[model samples]
Target: MAQTSSHVDSEDTVEYWLFPNISEDGDQLQELEAFRTRCFTFIQDQSQNYIWHEDSINLKVVTKRTAGDNPPHLYGKTRYGCNVEDEWFIVHLFRSFSVTENDVVIRIVDSDGDFLLVEAADILPRWANPESCINRVFIHVGQVHMISIADRPSSITPLPSGQPSLMDAVHIVRSMPHLTIAPSPIQEPIRQRIEKCVSQIDSSLHRCNVFVPASVAALLQSYPTLVAPAVHAFCQRDASQLQVIRAMRFFPPETRVWTSVTFTKCLYAMLVHRNYQPDHRTGWTLPPNGDPKRTGSELGMKLAVGFELLANEESLHQQGGDYSLEMDSRWNRFLNTLKEKGFFQDFLESSQPYNELLEKAREFYMNSVGVEGPAKKPVILRLMQSVFADIEKFKKEEAHLPADDDDSWLSVDPATLDQILGDKFGLLGVDDDEAKAEILPKLETFLHRKSDYEGLTPSSGRKKSRKLSHLAPPSASRKTSTLSNTSDVSQLSNHIGFDPDSFASAMQGILDFALPEDNWDLESNSSCLSSYSEEEEGGELVDKEMNNYMQTMDQELLSTDVLRTSVDNPTRKESVMSEGCESFSDVENFQPVKIDSAALESLLASYTMQRGGPGPASILLNQLNLPRSQISASKKQTD
Candidate 1:
């Protein structure tokens, strides 16, 4: 059974039928569910069919984790069934799933009813029409064809409403002969030539960042035979071979002009810059290695593919739809820039390299634009300088305008801002004497102390009036609870009665008892120690202090919940079934509580001061999945 549908707007109305080859056990359906979530975000399902409705399109997809039971739908019997809208999206699916025509029948329809039938209108059977083409056109092995109606399967059940359904189209299309129709005679030789020519590219010269132009993609989709010859010419980097456009007899007459113009501009760009540097971004490579210095198209089919690569980069910057005019503008701008760079002067046309390019351009004009053709032959040299006059003139016209205002707080000292904030917070309720008395002085002192201890003052903003060698007098610096280093050292020395000769002798005697004079590398006449008691006493004192510090740290760690809470509850939830899903549940399930970096830093600094170093802080950061190395790097950047 078949039904005909009239043409709608192809741009707004397009459909795709995906039939995946699943194993007998249907384990692949689970994988398809994952593919659906990762790629087609519109299809959200959990062991069920997902029907997506939109203004311009509709999708009925099966996104199940298992093939438990088949639903009573037109496509229920198949292992997997889904509809795709985007062309590249389908291609990605085919490649990722390793889909072949034999495994599953894939069909596409646009406003024209059948996309492939419209494309292959020149070669379809006479009996084929809108009615007959319905459910007949299918894509197999990367090629499009219309299957015979006689191949329809008998198992297709008719709908109760007496309307046609695509239930058996998959079986019929997949059952058809793999190579039902051979390549057209006209396309055969061109295909072989392209394969031979492109194969000559150096194996080491890897091509990347390649994007097919829309004009080229249309030909690939419909009239693929014509594409190879064009590609062959492009790889050769020769414009004279543009006579290949005449061979595209099956394509409409206007299509030849489109192909020729695209080929001409791209080929000419390459000829203009014969010694152009290789650009990895543009996938630019020199012509096939070991060719002649002044090589021209021997078979007259050479066209450069470089512009196709280069032009897409610009199209990507803008909305990537219909970039033919954009490519032309970019070509003109490229020539203009080269002219301003002094690549072509008055005598350049007479030079050997430019003259060769001019000759090729003339051939391109002759072949693409015949004597009776509507286009007039443009002078190649005249086109080169279509925009730029000279470097100085160009620079003057394109000079950047200065900004109107300076809205910079970059020059404001952070310390000054901190002080101002403290004063503002203190004066928040100054009208109430009780509140002012209670908050004002305490708030100011607390803020000042916090800022000072955290080293929030920028080194650049700090006054550098004092010399590094000159220590500040006691009154000049802020007082602390502990005695100054100078005072501590002076008092300790005075209390111990530190006589230089006696102190040195005692240290030498202790060292001799522990380390021995014979083991020393020095040649001085140092005697052995009287005893090892002095060295043993010092070692015992250090051990005793270390044990006390360890006991204090153990008591604190046991009392605090920092490490215990982290070990008990993790931020990111882990589960056996968890994957990289961006579903609502996955997104809402976990959200990190934001902590102020400054506060965290201040707290960590206090912990380090109490514990004697950054050892505990590093361990804490590790538990939080924030490595000390990363934190240190961030801290350095902030500083």
Candidate 2:
């Protein structure tokens, strides 16, 4: 017997050799069972009793199973089982190990004729008894081992310990109330493009580049919702950002119109937060009707119109209120000081014209005081009185001069007169007719003769005396002389005890003195006589006459209360000038000579001499000594 080849790819081959007793002699089955029991018992006892035997015996059983059927079975039957049972077992085992449909298990062959049972009883039920029926299949002879058993995974590879599984993560996101489903990862490139655009816009806005428009527009094209907030942020950082948005808006959808209002509001907010107070000086001045731009388009002119309305309302309120006069006065004073410091020119350029503001001020005053009669009277009176007092004080101080008897005269130099006239009255250069007509008479009056005798020159010889006679001109001489005598008497009365007899005697002596002779040829000359006479007699007489006249004028001027009243009320000067013709004696007395030939010549001579030359004075003096006819002819020729 070629030892039945046990390594066959069939379960029948191995099963038939292992247990033959089941089908053999019935009585002998007990002994066979006992032998099998003893074999198992021996292996169990050896495992319990000897540590080394445990491992060796385990190997023994495996060795026995691997060895072909002959030795193992022969030894078991002869030593432990009956002969009859052995023979019968072989045949019956072969029959009992027959392959059946239900028991069809896959068989795998080994090189050593050993087999591994891979059946329903040896593995988990899920694998052995799969819901789907499986037919056993055989594998050909080779060393074989089980690879993967078909089994149900414990909970589908239980979720990771701490982190959410893929499904869990998805489910959690789905369940969230606020979470929005993000665009798919497939759209990542698009999102990246949008992000890049936004970044560019942000960078451009920071750098204050105009490229912000293109960048912002591209971003909004992809993500429209981003427009408003982006604009807001941009504007918050830079007030001028709105300009970019406005430009972009011009492209499409008319975003500019919407942004215009928002931009204006934004500007207003920024200004208000900064406590921006516009200078009233810079307030827009409307043309008489309205600004052309404002008149054309309501929308275009909204800001201008609104500002105007606001300004008007404010003006009305201020006018209607009881404003602080003191505060206004202080502000005016401050403005004046600023003007004095040269800031007024800048202010005028930068601010409103002063005249407009002044008109506004007057309007405000009137409104505050009410429209009723006499409501503004007191303020006007006070203002006028203050001005009058200032004028009077200035006139008194400015008119003050050396007493008439003083040797030095306040004669104005011709150059100084020329400069003053040129600057004040816009005269330039000289015109002979104008000089003689407009200037000479004024000069003569202002120079008023130093002494009466000084007028008696040989050249002016009898003509001057004739003019003196005309002083109390022929028509008025009698009345003038009587008035003059009375005036002298009155003046004498004020200074000395009134003894009519002595006063008469003094007048007689004055009358008796011979008129001084015109002696231009004398050694001292007429000029010398004039000088001495003026010093002794003319000065004393002029001083006395002036004092007396001033006193009498004061008495008469005060008697009517005209001077006091006029001094108290300055508007009277214009009224009196218009209606009454009071001689301007005060003005005439204050007026200085239009030209002082001597003084001018002296100045020019000094200037010339200092520059190493003879002066204009010497030249003029020489010219002056020439005959009057020659002088007149020369003047006519020049003219």
Candidate 3:
């Protein structure tokens, strides 16, 4: 078995496998050779002779869980790992990265233990999540495979010896990738510990014989990790570190146990939010904590883990599987209470607008009176924003990336890859690839296209991808010349030919002569060029001529290329308008009337009144009990 897949710690990283096919690269092959050191050359088992040749290293693995059994296909032997053998290649450690049911996380720790994270893609080769645990694999004589060395008698714990370098082992295992399945079946003691926590909340969550809101039901399917991190270690709960994405709990954050009152409130919220079918009846038992008016990722915080397990052995009873999470009497009795309120797929995304909220609320108000369960697929709110917020809050971010979406089973481990892929009744979200596949049958119909609104945004529409894309990386330094000094100000001097007093007097005289004292006598420099006479034709003719000339100049300014460009630029247009009076510039500065208020109200009232069924006007009249307002204090004073 390989040692832990190493990650740089400043920023914690998840475990994942990289490069499934290792034969093509010569460098990769050489790197693989660097880690191999022959330990056992040959060994013999009952059926056949087992050979561990000089070049090939014996791969080792430990069972993910002692009780959980792997499917026959992934096992290295029929009963090879039932007993321990001296020749071991992989060793299982206490702490290894855990994988979702997919047996894969997109991240991979190569055989070298060099953490390799890849750009996520919708590709043929499926990506696994960051792995924390290396699974037990099948081993045989003269084999190039690995086997599980778990489920050995409790009395034996091997005195592990003669190990390769930890990193070297890691490189070898990852390079030749071992069979990684989920841990062995839940052992008896741990199963007992987990089953003890079962309550109405957990039972309802497990979808045993009771019903829950889509919100609560969805939580049940995913709460096991946080709820029961350890079935056997309740006394040492504080010692174990549990991190779940957006782990919510029952309201009043302090309430760990689920009560009937809490349950009612959760249902009320679904009703208010309109997460029910069109014909269901919403009961009147709404808890203040589950108010529908509330919105955001923190909508239901109390429903998180630290709760009980709702493990129904029936879901775990696979035909060829020997798995069961044992439950006690108290747990079974607690589940009976949930029979009345069935699960419904009425949860709407928090991002929806006011109108959608009203619509959903209308649908959810119906009671579950005769319904079995939610007829439609579960509605999962995409609360990625909330999930990432908590991740950043805890501070493991080396870069900005969304954490993996967790849809693992809440109680019965997770469904196999095939079961998960073929699922049609799951919730909708980034993690619900199977559900998304079912929903999005018209693939090309949803291909993203540029919104017309963006083009009409009246802002610069430069392609941001040009800057962000790797194809046209920005240059370190642009080639351009810098400005040099045109002249030296230190070398320049001022000269005056006359005394200060004389020069001042001369300048005053010049101003007096240059500026006319009379009101309309050659008012502008244009008067000198036009030679307009104020004495003839009442001076109105001169004013008209001046106005006409100014109008023509204004038109010329508007026609200029510079002014046209300024008009095209919103910033330039605003700046020019703010400076002073501009021709038609005030239009841009015009403030719109808040609404077409009076006229709009009148039209709506009239239309509603005419259409019947308490028209918009009648509704207003009904609110006030008067057709119109009368200004009078006489009645008020009498009262």
The number of clashing residue pairs in each candidate reads 6, 1, 53
lDDT of 3 by residue, 598-621 (tens): 332343447333433446543433
Ranked candidates, highest lDDT first: 1, 2, 3
Off by over 4 Å in 2: 1-465, 468-638
> Once superposed on the true structure, which residue ranges of model 1 sit more than 4 Å away at CA?
1-11, 23-31, 34-60, 63-102, 150-165, 179-639
Model 2 Cα shift for residue 225 (angstroms): 56
The worst-scoring run of ten residues by lDDT in candidate 2 lies at 51-60
How does model 1 fare in lDDT? 0.33
Which residue pairs does candidate 2 place in steric collision?
Answer: 20-89
Candidate 3 runs further than 4 Å off:
1-224, 227-285, 288-310, 313-475, 478-639
Per-residue lDDT for 96-135 in model 2, tens only? Answer: 2222211111222222232222221111122222211111
Q: Mind sharing the TM-score for model 1? A: 0.22
Q: After superposition, how far is residue 571 of candidate 3 from its true place, in Å?
A: 27
- Which candidate comes out best when scored by lDDT? 1
lDDT of 2 at 509: 61
